[model samples]
Target: MSNAAVLWRRVVAEAVGTGLLVTVVVGSGIAASSLSPGDVGLQLLENSFATALGLGVLILMLGPVSGAHFNPVVSAVDWWLGRRTGAGLTSRELTAYVPAQIVGAIAGAVLANLMYAKAAVSWSTTDRSTGHLWLGEIVATAGLIVLIFALGWSGRAAVAPAAVGAYIGAAYWFTSSTSFANPAVSIGRAFSDTFAGIAPGSLVGFVVAQLFGAVVGVGLLAILYPDAGRAADEIVTPHTDTTTTGATT
Candidate 1:
């Protein structure tokens, strides 16, 4: 496809994938809370599992077209990892993507909140004490990034979507933060005062922890899969030169 066509496709994929992710996440959160009142842990678990399934499906559906970067953190990390080594979205395009995700998330939260009366939607308060919550965020986000990079970027794993789904589902049980690995998703859920809300003040800790986890994941991947990143130039440079030679000849 032409560059313009590819760019448009990528944008559409991102928008649709992100929109679906947020909607399902918030919707599931609300559903869990309504079904099981006062059982915050179970509610969060349900939300996490649903999110994982939703994300996996969306990624599988959109990975071929746009890489399915439904979160800004993933997009930024992919760029930093040099995965966008060749003709990909520009800074301007990336800048636009985050806002679209945030907007979509907010819309999702609003719709979910409306589904279940706003008054019934209570903010999250399941032992997110300052210290414990921060620690949980760190562990949760780290695992998520590791899974994404390992299965999606490394190209060694078969059925990346299934791998990601399992990782998320496991992370929810293992990590204290219940596996809220995406900063955008975390912040977006905050808008809805439902089972997913992080108590506005809690957002800072979650975002910070998530960013730290991303950096850690990148570092670990660098060490564990050093050659994974080397493919970009090796493939692109040779292909470009070959094309040029063909044109000249």
Candidate 2:
């Protein structure tokens, strides 16, 4: 295949993976809400479990294709850290990946709502704007970045499916904002009005917090694993895996 063709394939994989991820996240939440009725904790448990399993599977399936970076923040961090190292994505890939992830995430939410027989594009009313919530976002996103990059440095790339999945599951409970660490996913959730949704009005602050968290994550990487910022012969990001197909988490 030509280089352009390869790039397009990767881009397509990213879009599909992200879309499916949102489908799993939003769909499960909607179902959980209905099944559990008024039990908030149960609903959250159902949603978190489904997300953990589904995300891990998606990463395993698509990582070899586009590094399965369903999250834009992950893609950005990967590109930033790996720009100089051949282990990371090129600028063109970074540009392509982030947009694909966002588009896919939105599509996924639409699909989830439709599957639940709801409106295709209703905005969420769940207002999550608050100082403490923003702080939670920053904490969640920063921890995510730190863990992912740290895996690369530790030469534990193969465990990313379990590690990343588990961390997200834990973050959902420990963090106040339910850990909307993925910017693309959060934007997509804004278009949903179901249990997993976030208010559109709150997107700006959440995204800002996430970005700041990414910076903090990078700083931590420098301190704990100074050499992890650049890619090495090993996989540079959590998105890449042991498969020859180039699967990412």
Candidate 3:
């Protein structure tokens, strides 16, 4: 097959993987909320487990195809860091991946809403626009990016499914905003007003904070493992993990 065809396959993988991931996240949150009414803690626990397990499974299933980024930030960062290494997405590939992931995320939220018999396209009114919330997002996203890239550098790519999932699950309780680490996820979650949604008004802050976190995460990777990142040059840089999803969201 041609190179374009290969990239297209990866693009499709990203779209499908991100879509299902969002669906799992939103759907689980809805189910958890419904089942554990008036019990916020229990609902969160339920959401976190389902999200963590589903994310891990999706990564394991689709990592070989698209590196399982599913997040625009992940895809963009991968392209930037791995460009010189030749083990990353091409500019063309990067362009394709981000939009596909975003579209998939939106679709996933809509699907979840439809499944639960809610308005399929209404904006979320969860209003998470606090400064501290943005700070939490930055912290969560930075930690995620740092973990994923560091693992790739250390040649422990196989641990991603478990480690990434665990970090998100843990970050949920620790972070005030429940760690909406993925931009695509933030966008998707904005569409739902249920237990897992974020207000559209807060999208900018969240996304900007995430991007800032990505920068910090990548910088830390460069400083801490100056030589380790070189190892990712030869193999596909598998910096894996995401901020959005029921588990982390």
Sort by TM-score, best first.
2, 3, 1
**What is the TM-score of each predicted model, taking all chains together?**
0.79, 0.93, 0.91
Best by TM-score: 2
lDDT measured at residue 145 in model 3 versus the true structure, 0 to 100: 78
| Model 1 C-alpha lDDT per residue in residues 140-225, reported as the tens digit of each score | 76666666666544554336567677777787788767777777777667776666666767777788888888888778878876
Q: Is candidate 1 or candidate 2 better by TM-score?
A: 2
lDDT (Cα atoms) of all candidates against the true structure: 0.65, 0.84, 0.81
lDDT per residue as tens, model 2, 93-116: 889989999999999999999999
Point out where model 2 deviates above 4 Å. Answer: 232-249
lDDT of prediction 3: 0.81
Per-model tally of clashing residue pairs = 0, 9, 4
Candidate 3 residue 162 C-alpha distance from true site, Å: 0.8
- Residue pairs with backbone overlap in model 1: none
Q: How does model 1 score by TM-score?
A: 0.79
1 or 3: which has the higher TM-score? Answer: 3
Q: Which wins on lDDT, candidate 1 or candidate 2?
A: 2
Top candidate on lDDT is 2
